[model samples]
Target: MAHVVSAMASETSPEDLTDLSLEQLLNLEVISASRLGQKSSQAPTSVSILTANDIRTFGWRTLAEALNSMRGLFTSNDRNYSYLGIRGFMRGGDYNSRILLMIDGQRMNENIYDGGYIAQEFMLDMDLVERIEYIPGSGSSIYGANAFLGMINVVTKQGKAIDGSQLAGEIGTFDTYKGRVSYGKTLKNGTDLLFSASHYDTAGVENLYFPGYDSPETNNGIAHKMDDERADRLFGKIKFEELTLSGGYVDRGRHVPTAAFDGIFNDPLFFTDDKQFFSNLKYEKALNENTSLLLKGFYQGYDYYGDQAYIVNDARVINHDEASGRWWGGEAQLTTHPFEGHRLIAGLEYQYDQRQRLLNYDLDPYLPYLESHRNGHRVEVYLQDDIQLLDDLVFSAGARLDYHHMLKNLQLNPRVGLIWSPLTNTQFKLLYSSTFRAPNAWERDYNAFGFVDNPLMREEQIKSYEAIAEWRSDSNLRLLGTLFYNDISQLLEGHLTGDADGNYALINAGRFHAYGGELEAEKRWSNGRLLKASYTYSLLTNENRHGAWANASPQNLFKLHYAEPLFDNYLSLGLESIFIDSRKNGLGGKVNGYELVNINLSSDKLIHGLDTSFGIYNVFDSHYQMLGVSENIDVLRMNGREFRLKFQLTF
Candidate 1:
């Protein structure tokens, strides 16, 4: 298989891209995740690339909005709380512990609770984002522990990418307002610096269906007051040849209304403030004509106050508390091509996390509070061979071995891929990979209301197989289809032990299977018009557990996007449609699914130094839910028909 793929790849020649638009850059190869410059189709897993043009066309305000349109990805809203589940397994807000987020190869997910706060929007200013590369599968082989669910790598804009300083702002319904300013400069010594700041505020829309309260004296009630939110953020980056450094800070505060309250209800307040700093240094020395040695190192720090809630029940009850923590880690990697068609990558990583709870209502009143801390060290080595057997086929295989100090366990992940190009414009690929997820801090030490910690938890593992076919016609039509199956073992399920205090401890249990398929097609017209569409269907079943079939796994997900030039290259119109099938919530109850439509009209013409845009989201005001957890406030309310008009000027 490897020989066939290598031969086919060598037979084909690269294309000339002088006429391709910026939007077409989505098809370019992604280099961040794999540390290898490989196209998404060649990867052994599901990968999605969102280009800068796509971001602008969609008018996405945050990373969440951009991800919502992707196939196989799901999102749910719960006021200041948000949840993301990929493939099938999903939990509510504070999911950073399971999924991993990286910025320019630096880990950003907080270590506490096994996750970071996803609802704290505005963590990354959209204006500064150059592009986003997403891989929806286990990344533990390369990223270590938190790469359980998948990886989202945010690629920021460099000073070289921007022409000069720019400023922009927007105002819309529900008292929503946003503003941003950025500057970029290049030094004489081939170095560059870029800085940006943005702010967003909103008086949230009314999402509740039922109006006022009913009393013994009357059955009539008034409409519930809608919750509101406000946020601010700052980001900066500097680049010097092979070395890049970046940092940012974000502060977000929001207030959410209770389900049963009008003016006399509970109002939960959430505040999250986080800081991120990281640097990447790389050096390359040529060993010979066909061999070279490359070295790289990265360090990152993330600190935040996550989901601190002040709960007021009825009139006499007052519950106030907060959870805070910090996570810091560093990685060093070395790569060498000692032989022709052979590549070797080796890395070592170390991470330490400390969590402190200042106040806990459930802890023993007399016992002294103990600050919980967890430190982890991981060392790994991996090697791969991309053999070029013939002019039309390519074969690649690799394996990774990692040692974890906390788990006292060693993991081995292996992957193999074969690419065969029978035709100049068509490719067929087969891939198989094994990956695993280490138990997070929360899964091991969480002892809260009705949830007990399990110290002897085992890591979860998955073996996946995938096949893909892609055809790119010379007439500007592209079609792609993929089929995949995953066998998962060591799934962690909570073991319930009913105690006097109604607390339940979690014990690892169960094995599962997940299978899915995706199809996508794109067409580009000669007149600068294009259409993109995709569909995904998946089934996730817990083979060991009875009556556990009705969870948040959608049977069908579909999307359609259209873009056309309205007036030469100065004006354009964009439309998008997203559809999701009905699925069950965490409690095994059915939830309705709906379709959403959005439209945007924008231009690249600069008036003075300003670039301008006008757009509308939820054009039809369709009501829908992104995600649903058990008994949690259902995030069913959709953003109403809203208009966002903005102008960005560059100096």
Candidate 2:
């Protein structure tokens, strides 16, 4: 889809990207993909950015929707939760603990479950986001933990960008209603602040049917009047010179429609709740022309609650499960350019988990099943360097060491990369990296109702090697290619084992290997008209038979986005499409391919200050399914066609 760049953006403008020379385009600065800020052409890894203009033009409400448009990535929704599948590794029951999610360089993954929310439940509203950067590959070398598959970095808008107060509203299909109020101010003293609050609600999917539970005991596999969702969000930020403060909070609830975990089907009483609060203060100082220092302190709290209805003791009853956590951390970093063609960056971080707790009980009979509480802490240090041997050759390397109370040994991760600009319009890169994910509170302590716990479980490890090439022609055309090989070992998986308390325990099951490549091409015009397409091919295998489920990720993925300006930039129209190929499922069956198409129209000044957008999703209403397990419902069906209309006004 087409996107309109605003004056407040810090990224390279569409005009510059389309009309500028190759040498000028190579000077754009970017962060997140590499902790050290560097030019886009020199960044060690592959990076993709989606700006606020794109978000508005595409009419995307959730991060998941925006991610679907990104290359080498896709998400599968089972009506209960959405899981990110990266480069052909989509585990069925995972909580997206493999991908690290960050808001302004701060980690968002919780300690209790090692989970990151990317759906409507995400902490901040989409309107407050300035840009989203997707970094594909292992990242633990600098982040220290939970950066296995990929990483997502979200940058928020500055107060000067908003300028004043704004109001927005939207009413869409499925009775979805949303409203927001925001204010921003920038004083003459170089102080700026932004505050916003939003509310959203929807009566999602009134009824649905499942064929897996077609017995009289489970309401004949039908779910009715049980799909509803709502959320309230608050966010604020302030900055003055070298000091900055930011905080955010969110509370979300969703009604279960799939009757998962053997819960009663068609019941309206099954639901889940998520709440989070985070605050941080940061300071920075430039000691000299080529050296700087940064310090930050942060606090975070989280709570998760769930209620499921079940047939217990020949009666309808409820199972209540809850978890809450709190933690505080601090970090210090220093950067120096001590000599010519040499730059070095170093950092140290410490985090203390104040409280990690989980509880399971019965609401109908007033009984307690399990209660677990634990405290943990972590320490980490890292260093990275960049060297420019020649005008056309560059080398980068980094490593990190981490120590955790629950982990028996210290973990060390490392990364190395090389970049060569053979021609003014062509660049090549080679990279190698290692990352890991440690066991979380649930995996280490909670054996609540039926699952077993193995405290001896270790961290999961990954090693990756990749080669990339990017080329640009004089006609404003771009071509890019990337190939990678990933080896995953010491994977934590829950298997049916004859343990004393239950039948399932988490252990280091086996090894998995994957190799894939992505190809993309794009053409752009001086008028902001864009046409882009990409294709992906992957072949994934494993050392053991049980790891076949990881192949749920599509073997072939095709994506296209096109847009054209009409009526002298007053109106815009765009189209998007995605095609996925069949994949081998865990049950020895093959899941068929599906294609989705979307169209949208928007006008910026049709009514002067009133921006309007209309869109249609899933135009063909194709039905596709994803892999599932016993604890979660399979035979799940995706959403059909839907319509959206939105309006926003600024003062």
Candidate 1 wrong stretches, greater than 4 Å: 1-27, 32-37, 94-96, 116-122, 138-142, 206-226, 258-265, 268-299, 303-317, 354-359, 362-371, 525-527, 546-548, 606-608, 626-635
User: All models: lDDT?
Assistant: 0.61, 0.78
lDDT of 2 by residue, 402-475 (tens): 99877999999888888898887788888989977788888898675577778789989899888989888877
Candidate 1: tens digits of C-alpha lDDT, residues 410-461: 8888777777878867777777777776776556766654676777887777
> For every candidate structure, what is the RMSD over all alpha carbons to the true structure, in angstroms?
5.1, 3.7
Candidate 2 global TM-score: 0.93
Error of 2 at 190 (Å): 2.1
List the lowest-lDDT window of 10 residues for candidate 1: 1-10
- How many steric clashes between backbone atoms does each model show? 26, 0
Clashing pairs in 2: none
